[model samples]
Target: MKALQLSAPKQWEQIEIDEPSPPGPGEALVRIHRVGVCGTDLGGYLGKFPFFSYPRIPGHELGVEVVAVGEGVENVKVGDRCSVEPYINCQKCYSCERGLTNCCESHQTLGVMCDGGLTEKMILPARKLHPANNLSYEQSALVETLAIGCHAIDRAHVTEKDTVLVIGSGPIGLSAIEFARVAGARVIVADLSQTRLDFVTEKMGMTDTIQFDGSEADIEKLEAMTDGRRADVVVDATGNHHSMRRAMEMAAFGGRVVYVGITQQDLQFPHAPFLHRRELTILASRNALTGDFARIIQLIESGVIDTDPWITHHAKFEEVIESFPAWTDPESGVVKAVIHIS
Candidate 1:
């Protein structure tokens, strides 16, 4: 078996590993077909992601095929193509008891807390695989990425009446924009990268956008777009401390602000009085729920959510060591990058 591992910061190594054994009870052996690269992977590559560990096989967004199922496994069978829900949670935790498995106390996301599916095959719980046989391997690989946006929009309770301002036009931010549009909300995207902004407007059909200048003028521009009402729901997906801090300022009175992007640094916002006056709702959205994965798969299969334009780059498993570093550069214009494992 061959696998790509991040041996250290800014270093990638391809090495041979023993093939995985047959699945145990309630488990499934899955051959990885595709791996979607996201900010987490980029963070790990640069040694910035908090949960990432060295010498890790970094792949969580996966499209896989079941090779075999162990005894007592029924959710999936051999030959089924599926999307892997990479969040491995302890069912006995407090969050799990309340059906909030996305934030279980002992949650271990693949590619972060543990070794992941960057290799040819691996074994995982059968329940984590959501079959998407009708969709392409590329579409299946994008489910987990889109589910992040889906879950964030769900957290904000966006609707047609709301005006959503999504900060950052990266993959995560784009995911939120897609769902917000599906909900009939007027979605406006903001990003510092003109290339990304152009990609969203031109390729994604999103006309409303702000080229963030990192000034109060940017808020003024947003106000101009929303008829001075500002955003009814603001989603900050930049994972930058400054962007997260500025998110609250973009929301309307009594509006909701959902932080889907994360940063390990402590953030301090000095507008306590302003926050109280607006009576805003602030939420921290974590990983997606199992239901989100199923919903995204169905959405893609139904053509309600298009995956055609999401992937901007591709590489085979063996080429990742040479190509991965370039994808980390924002100027590369990589909205989403996928590694073909099969």
Candidate 2:
């Protein structure tokens, strides 16, 4: 088997490797069909993702087919199609006790914390697998990313009537738009690039789009969009510290702000205003839980989610070395790029 292995920071190679064995008890050996590339992979390649380590098989978001099932794994069987919840959590933690499995004290994430799906096969805990009827492999690979939007909305406690602002037009940002809409909020998206804003508005049917130029007009337009109250909820999908910090001032008084992006710097918050006025809730939404992965599958199945344009690029496994760099550039408009594994 040929797997894209991250041998070190800023280095990756398509190295030949042995295939994983059939499932052990409570596990399933899955043949990976599609592996989605995201900012994390790029960050990992650049040696920027916080938890990334070398020699890691870098993939998590995937569409996998069950090739073999371990003893006592009755939840799924050979030939079943499923998506994965990439976190392996310690079941006894306080957070896990409260159903926040994603925050379990000892958390191991595939791709980053251990060898993952950037290969032909993976042996995963059966409990972390989610089954969907007739789900496409490429689409299944996206459930994790889309679940980021769902998780952010979950943390925000957003209702159907809230005014939400998503501060990015990339895949995660667009995902936030969908789940926000599903939550019944009038969604608005912001970005520095008109091209991304245009893609969201013209093609994605997002009603409000703002060009973030730090101009008075942009702020005023945002104010007007929120009926003079500012955003009731703000989701920063940019993963850039500057944009995320600015959102503290952009949200409505007493509103919630969710940071879905990963950043390396220590973030600062405006004190006086942030302290005096609102009962502001600042949340950091990380990886998806198994349940969120399940919801993502259902959302896609029920027509509440459309990932058609999200999968904007594809490459054969052999072409990853040449293709990875191009997919990293914003100029490529690469929303979601996938590698097909044999």
Clashes by residue pair, model 1: none
The residue-by-residue lDDT of candidate 2 on 58-127, one tens digit each, is 9988899988999899888889999988888989989999988987889888898888898888789998
lDDT of 1 by residue, 214-259 (tens): 9999999999898888999999999999999889999999989999
Q: Each prediction's Cα lDDT score?
A: 0.93, 0.86
Ten contiguous residues minimizing lDDT sum, candidate 2? 270-279
Candidate 1 positional error at 69, Å:
0.2
User: Which pairs in model 2 have colliding backbones?
Assistant: none
Which model scores highest in lDDT?
1
lDDT of 2 at 130: 90
Residue 117 Cα positional deviation in candidate 2, in Å, after optimal superposition: 0.5
- TM for candidate 1 is 0.98
**Candidate 1, residue 280: CA error in Å?**
1.0
For model 2, the stretches where C-alpha displacement exceeds 4 angstroms are 215-217
lDDT of 2: 0.86
